[model samples]
Target: MSDLTRKTAAELSELMASKQASSVEVTQAHLDRIAAVDGSVKAFLHVDTEGALAQAAAVDAKRAAGEELGPLAGVPLALKDVLTQEGVPTTAGSKILEGWKPPYDSTVVKRLKAAGIVILGKTNMDEFAMGSSTENSAYGTTHNPWDLTRIPGGSGGGSSAAISAWEAPLAIGTDTGGSIRQPGAFTGTVGVKPTYGGTSRYGLIALASSLDTPGPCARTTLDAALLHEAIAGWDPMDSTSINQDVPPVVAAARNGDVSGLRIGVVKELGGDGYQPGVEARFHEAVELLTKLGAEVVEVSCPHFEYALPAYYLILPSEASSNLAKFDAMRYGLRVGDDGTNSAETVTGLSREAGFGDEVKRRIILGTHALSSGYYDAYYGQAQKVRTLIARDFIKAYEQVDVLVSPATPTTAFAIGDRINDPIAMYKNDLCTIPSNLAGNAAASFPCGLADEDGLPVGFHVMAPVMRDDLLYTVGAALESALAEKWGGVLMSKAPELVVNR
Candidate 1:
């Protein structure tokens, strides 16, 4: 029998329908895992245990009533702290908003609930999703399940870690640059960055509005697709939400395969920046794809070299504008409440006290970049660079089906290694930011274990805009081939975390 904790959400739904297990039994199993291992992993910021159990009871009642059920009916899911959940203290891992409960749910949350996916709780994230590692979280750092002291990637680290640690079977995460996919690679799980506007952003706390995208984080591509389908559709509230109809992702995943498709390996992304083991694994995955009849060849998107610099300029410029609404007098944590304070004082004090170093750094950089005289030189020039990068991808797509590269330039680095060096941390997302800026869909799946530290390495697959299904097709082909070649799944290599039941 499959381990209840590790069963995919699809399996849980099937089990619930067959009366083989109750939703309470399954949801509690995941909740129990969180209670057991989360002290060290620190994956969750807040878990709604009563709400979760209550929802589980409702799922049971539905089954008892013989009503029609959704595909994700009874599956438990974790939300990134950046996404708002109704009546839940949605602290985006920032001390400034610690106790602020949102009055409504993000559209993604609404859809997931409609699908009957139980809310396991909110996962930790970088304060305002500013950093590439969970170390930037105002609450606390999340430990990698593979190696407790090592880092799990962020700003989606909590959602990534939860799945890796078996706290939940599925979760929602966002990617502004590499937040979702890098964390997935670091934690040995599957993370997808859907095409820009593929999912609605109605209530997700804005973080670089142009690049932010919410998608699924899970242990397998099929699982990710199942979750992705649950929340993806046209949302009138979000002006950017694509109006084009998306076919059922679950059906696509069930039939996914890339037997004779073309795969272009990006020539520029991985070089001196990559760890030797990561490069080795990348090449190994390529060889397997070639063997599986993918027409693998090197393709160049030369402007990719300038993506990091451009991303830094554009993301903060947009973020500076997007995050302006959280003034203390209006919403979020407040300070200077001696009854003698003006609105401005309370807002200033609250932000000054609550934001972490990284958030403050970006805010400063953004304010400078968007200032009167420097706007054209910095922000405007960066948009020109963004145009060039997008053009580069558009030109290259004319000759290939999808592109490949290392999801990150390196495997997960040790904790505190890049903390003091802001540029070093930014460099980690060099390969990922390009996809976000270009508004294309991408995914990162485990290729193999790195030889040096024995950590997992992820191979990135990128496709043009609105072609998210292409990611799964190529991803499944590579995943199946790599697993067969490696003799097992990457999580099989993860060392067991000893915990008392």
Candidate 2:
């Protein structure tokens, strides 16, 4: 592997700025890394070799002309397949949209391009972003770089896996539940879910309209923060986009000091279901924060326990409505159109052929939830629970600057372990669901590895809505302190993947 492939996005930018390396060199290095190891890691759904190189060349030319550039200019990034990039195939990991190239750029994509970042290609995801494991992807499961036998947490697993495996230093992920943070925890990378509506959702393949949040993934907190700034801001195209200044996340990440900051350890997120190693690492991270001069206290959000069920109900209901656009009559995967078949039959045939098991399951559950007799009982009740969860966050934030928890209950489970058990699969997001329910900013940073499995455990931090800078503050502090003990970033501890050629 080339040394360029291992450098952080920030480091790569500095190299380009100093004229020590051209953008094409950095972009090609990552492309080569993907070629060498992606066969084993399977992080990318598509590799836009030609497009990425061309973008890199343009950046190099602009730099040679002495034009101003952003901090992340010329850095290569992996985009989740759920986002549309004009003329690039976006599958959302389902056959329904297989080979569909969008005609326009998503707000996120437009921002990335404007920043002069090279688009590496689309990464795999759970079909329609439905499940917690990439096993639901019609393409294939994204294996954890730590252990190929285990899963890279999903529906944005490919994005996380790409960063973990060093195929790309940065990637984009959407968190509807725990998709970004859970996968970050499992892969020992940094993942951030900006405050809901904080990042524009325009052109993001919607899983749940209200819950879906596009965010950044990287091997380091500052790198994640840089990407977060590049993609986050007010967008006139999205009705839900927050009309406010993007938080000073990059500054907070650079600050990395938690001295005098009040940190809360959530009373509801630990014990019982949490693995001993996960809990051990989590508590140690808290102690480290306290030792670094932060005030630590245990806070309660009782409604968090109801977040999982409430999230399931709300997500599917929204997904059912959002996914209705794929009817075989408009675009993407058509079937039973032999000229004699009725429109309804063609739509049914296309849907049955296009959607995978998980997508179909959620659509049915959502349809039922929205049905006349059940809407008031199921969906309405879930909305009430969501409100309670939000209120719990509001109440807790009144006492604490931020809340902390184990990002997930355990390290990455072996692939297929919970695939057959839907309820078990759903429980993976237990600690993460409440944040999505509340529409607040949350992130996961690698604290330490679990002793039993020797896999990474994430230290999760939650800040109030729009206080995304605080999430970076806590993450950077933890990352710096932990790096001193480990002698390097936690990703350096991951087992190296065998190169293909």
Candidate 3:
């Protein structure tokens, strides 16, 4: 039998429905894995085993009474700390809100509950999901499963690490820039950032609101699709959420033949500046796509060169406005002497003490960008640049079914290697960040193992807006072929973990 902790959500659901395993049994197995391995990985900020088991028991009771179960019934999943979970302290991996338990659940969390998935608890992240490495997390850095001294990509590193380490089969993560896909690439798991508004954002703590997206991080492409379907679609609270028909991702994953697919290689990425091993594997992935009868074509997006600079400007500007809401009086941790200080002083003190260095730097930079004279020069220009990038994707998609690129420039780096050189750290997302700027659907899965470090390397597959089902179709095909080619799943090659706990 597959290890319960590592089985994909689809497989677990089948076991639950067939009465071969109780929801509680599945839930406990995941909790056990977290207890066993996540300590060394440092994936979770917290793990709510009690609440998870309670929810599992409820699902078991429903099954006992012959009630109809939800499609992903009883699956245990984690929320990236950036999302609010009722009764759990929703720290955005920053000290500012360390003990603040949200009174309500994020829309994604609510929907997952309605679908009967148990909440395992919040995972760690870069503070406010701002950085490329989880080293920025106030709690501590999350280590890559492939090598403990290396980083799993961020700001979804916690979720990626958790899934890759076998702590949980699935988790929800937010992506702004390359947060989701890059982590998936680094950790050798599957992570998707659906088209903007493809998944609702209500109750998620804000981070570059226009660019922020929440989606699934899972062990397999099909499982990521399953979790996505459970939480996708319009929510009355989120005005941006599209009210269109949610696609049949699960069906698409199962029907994964890419015979007629047209895979476009973005001419802008995956050449120089990328690691030799990463480029080699990415080329092999293109060959695999070609072997599957895909019409391999090279397409150019001229404005894509502008993606990084524009992304930095716009994301920070929006983040400044969004984070302004975290004043001392309203929510989260408060500082300053209670009786002697005025609220303004307390607010200043609270913010000063709460935010991490990166968070403070962005806030200051954003503040300057949005300040009176610079608004038109910085933020305004970035918006127009965003428009140009979007237009580029629309034009590219006209000739290709989906776009492909190297997921990250290279494999995981040593924990503190690039932390001091912000630009160096930022370059890691060069190939992966454009999708966020364009608000399109994209996913990352292992393509091949990099010979340099024997760590997994990912190939990015992107589809036009709302064509997320295509990502799954392509991902499933590549995953199956690559696994067969590599002689096993990438995670099977991860070093056997020794749990400190």
Q: What is the C-alpha RMSD of each candidate to the true structure, in Å?
A: 1.3, 0.9, 1.2
The lDDT for every candidate, in the order shown, is 0.88, 0.94, 0.89
Off by over 4 Å in 1: none
Cα lDDT for residue 467, model 2?
98
**Model 2, residue 443: C-alpha shift (Å):** 0.3
> How accurate locally is residue 199 in candidate 2, as Cα lDDT from 0 to 100?
99
Worst 10 residues of 2 by lDDT: 1-10
Clashes of each: 0, 0, 0
Model 3: per-residue Cα lDDT over 172-246, one tens digit each: 998888899999999988989998998988998899988888999998888999999999998889988988988
Give residue 451's lDDT in candidate 2 (0 to 100).
91
List runs of model 2 lying over 4 Å from the truth.
none
Worst 10 residues of 1 by lDDT: 247-256
Model 2 clashing residue pairs (backbone) = none
Ranking by TM-score: 2, 3, 1
Residues 30-124 of candidate 2 have per-residue lDDT tens digits of: 99999998998888999999999999999999999999999999999999999999999999999999889999999999999999999999998
If both were scored by lDDT, which would come out higher, candidate 2 or candidate 3?
2
lDDT score for candidate 2 against the true structure = 0.94
